[model samples]
Target: MSNAKRALQTEDLTKIEVFSDPQLSPDGNFYSYVSTKANDKDDYNSQLFVQSLNGDTPVQWTFGDVKNSNLRYSPDGKKAVFQSTRSGLPQLWLLPTEGGEARQLTTFKNGASNPTWSKDGKFIFFHASLDKDDDIQNQKEASKEERQKEQEDKKKQPLIVNRLKYKSDSSGFHDNKRVQLISLNLESNTFTQLTNNDADHGFQDVSPDGKQVLFAANLNENADYELSNDLFLLDLQSKEYKKLTDGNGGYHSASFSPSGDKVVSFGDEYEYAGATLTEIYVFDLASGERTCLSKSWDMQLGDLMIGDTRMGQSETGPVWSKDESSLFFIATDYGATGLYKVSLNKELTTLYKEDNHVFGFSYDQDKEAFVLGISSATNPCDFYYLKNDGTLTKLTKSNDAFLNEVAIAEPETLSVKAEDGKEIQGWLLKPYGFTEGKKYPFVLEIHGGPHAMYGQTFFFEMQLLAAKGYVVLYTNPRGSHGYGQEFVDACRSDYGGGDYKDLMTAVDYVLENYSFIDEDRLGVTGGSYGGFMTNWIVGHTNRFKAAVTQRSISNWLSFYGVSDIGFFFNKWEHGLNLLDDPAKLWEISPLRYAENVETPLLILHGELDFRCPVEQGEQLFITLKHLRKEVEFVRFPGANHELSRSGKPAMRQERLNHICRWFEEYL
Candidate 1:
């Protein structure tokens, strides 16, 4: 047989398995995780798996096309609880860790998630949504026929919106259902409502003693207008709770210390609103005093790296050590997310540092080891057993077979000086099967979040572009995380000013340094904030031969009202609301310069996107068409802002095809 490699295709999306949420059993002899993959049914399939440290074959715990995730272990390591959708809506399921059939636990009508076992393993606490007047105890799941009627009834009723933040990109328009807390007694097989309010409560952690539960919420009288996520401690017996943080800031991912007298969390004071760098804090439960642990740490905490393949959420910490002397957590620094530790006195130390993205981790406090979920440019993600002494051992090779059959491109790190002499970091991937002197078309990829960083994560789109013989360049420009607080805060109130210049500078550096790139055949593309930048780039300059913008923002004036967070996002980023200064908002909008666009543009948007509403794309398309400019618009039905990331499987493949077709035609 001839030895050859195949190019990574968009159809391979279903072939690549995504691994996340590695949970080490309390005994340190085993670990469990969730493996997700896009299935042939145009949806995703995620299942739970457990592996032993003694070199036992990994055992698949859950099965089917349904999603079984968020696995949590009991203190005794005899039982595990996880959320699953096998019975229709996602509900808590109990599993016998050793060996037995998994049994359904909760049947709440609105569904249940984020299961946390009580210290004594007698009760399991979870989060669920319910209407204000709806009884939360022993709520039954609605029948299929009832759900169909409910959908039809909802369509007939007019959506009455009275709040500034009513709609969300993920879950369209808001309903009367509010996220509340619930508890299940394993012995009695009974359910009880823990908290009841109009506002939503995010379940955080249960105290070690199990007498109190920790959560995050904004329960102010005017919660509709507030954005603060205050930490709360609720007495499970009395059903009473006390606010832990002042109402001025937002806090989350909180957990009670082993002693239960203190809480450690990640939060910010809304200094820059969404752009504010999240810091670590410890709250003294007795005096209600809060101490900022990472106040002087300039880097952003937690994983802020942007990628299309990661499927599940990871453990964001300050996970306390067995002795409670220090805590370990993930932090984004430079261009990568690494495992780091901070002592009570604020002395920081790096435990597992690498150029790869460490998305999820679980600490085996007894063994002083960790089960880490890591991903990189060539591999999707895999689990590893990491020792405190810096020893690393690969556990499961989720994508090794797939990697051996395909040709993948690795990115080379690059840095350049912006117009104002500020440094910007980025990466360049040369076209696969590249020849030394052959010139290839270049594509500049931008990331959203203006606050999120693009690091050494496996990006399917970037690799696909390289396979098609296009040199790809992606950068973490100003406003991106991982950089210092000053650098991240610099993009706020500036938008297209400095951030745009940083992106342009990155392109210039690549063109100047790389001989294999053809500058005249350059293309540009991005989604969300990156999409806004793509629109701005084409409008401000005619250098790019083609451009594709996905789920973008064109008009700040319209976005202020139509978007779910429009009203506040504008003021936070641009420093002015629509009412504050209409002209200022209009002046910064990309639509204002649509007539100046000369590059052929492809506008891809999800019809159901409420964050950067589909109207944002419609307005731009119409404006460019009216001006007789080169433009085309493609709308994905029933999709949302995450169309490029976790949208439907078929839609995702089609989206990639459109992007490549646009560049191939223009270049």
Candidate 2:
């Protein structure tokens, strides 16, 4: 029997376990988190696990092959509440922390989520989708027969959407149901519908006194044409709300101060629309005064590190200190996400600024420490206890067993000077089990979000490619977050201009510096914005032997009309609308240059992707075929824009294999 470390394979994705959503108890004795792993059934199993700070082993609190997340402990720490799909749809479930079996709390038709306990822990506030005249107390899950009949009825009716934001990439086509806030009384066993308006209300927090709820919503009559998501404070007794924001931009992730006299929130004025950097603000309740705390900061707020292995949500906060003197938050900067603190006196301090990703965290006021979810190039994710003096203590080695079995690739960080003398950050993964003086095929990976960043995080796809004996290169070019605001917004209105040069320059730099890379046998791939760039790259240059574009945009003209976000995203990103400047859109469309494409391109798209839409790939494939160019199209059934990241486990494996096969055949 051989006992050697094995390279990570595509199928190993199912074996990788992900940890996130860490919540330290009020007393700081125990913490709860969600651990997710892909199963053999082509689905993911996410459950809650609790561990005490006194070195107790993590206890699995929830069971079954169901998704159980959003764990919140009661104020007394005797019981905990979480959202689970064990009983069909996702609804609130309560379990005693000391002992006993779990009990379902809400039976809403649409399923309740975003559960938060009130200060006294007597009620649970959450949000659910409801129609205008629907009953809030309609807490019965429809039977299988009724659900089937409703689906049939829905198929017979035509969707009449009057608003521009009628559909989303995550939720698909919009219906009459609008997300509304609801509260469940644990003692009385009663449910109360808080806000009954046409607009969707996002539950943020409940006041310390339990008399008010802070939420985000645009109650304006013309919200259909607006992009503002203002914050509002609602009085539980009066059922009336007071607008806290000026309604000029978007605001969210708000929370009350410990004293309950002020509110801290994260927002932006939409100065550059989607490219705006988030700023923190503090609102004085009595005087109605607002102060921008992060006005001088130029980076984006929250975790902007793009990775596929991350699952479940973590609180990105301007979490108030116990004494209400300062707040702590996470910010994206220079290819890394770090924990920072800002005092009320305008003093800023870096708590933990390592060259890694702090994906999620929870602060413990009692110990004045933090439980951080950290990930590096070699680690998927592990929870750690970080002190105020910059000390770190490992809390969980969730992936230690997998790490021991698999040989992971460690990315080497590289910074290249762009053609314009700007610095572009990137990482290179050498071929697994590489030998000296050997030339390896190179694959350049581009990231989507043209606004998101490629940082020091565990990416299974890149590792799989490295295992397949290909040198993988990924970069955070212009228009990627983590850099300053100017760098991130540089790609707007110049999709294939500066951003394209940045990528090409990075490739040139890598080829010139790395003697082990075979420049002649180069390949490129990306999704979403990266997908668009992949198409653009093939059309403009034939330097690569093979290319793979997933959920890409081939024609900007069609993309402006068919995409769920096409209507407004085009104007915000391209600085042109389909109605006024059709010529400019046509000039940027990759479909127009299909005749010039010499590289063998592979197009992968999700059939249900509304973000880029399947038509984009179809157009590219048809044009390449008409031009007698080498091209192949593969579509995943029931997949969306996130097919490469969080799509079906089986489909993700197939997509990965197709990518590897294409490069193998051409490169």
Provide TM-scores for the models.
0.98, 0.98
lDDT of 2 by residue, 252-271 (tens): 98999988999999999989
What alpha-carbon RMSD in Å does predicted model 1 have with respect to the real structure?
1.5
Model 1, span 354-420: residue lDDT tens: 9899998999888889988999988999888898788899888899899999988988998889998
RMSD of 2: 1.6
> Model 2: number of clashes?
0
lDDT of each: 0.90, 0.91
Window of ten residues with lowest summed lDDT in model 2 = 1-10
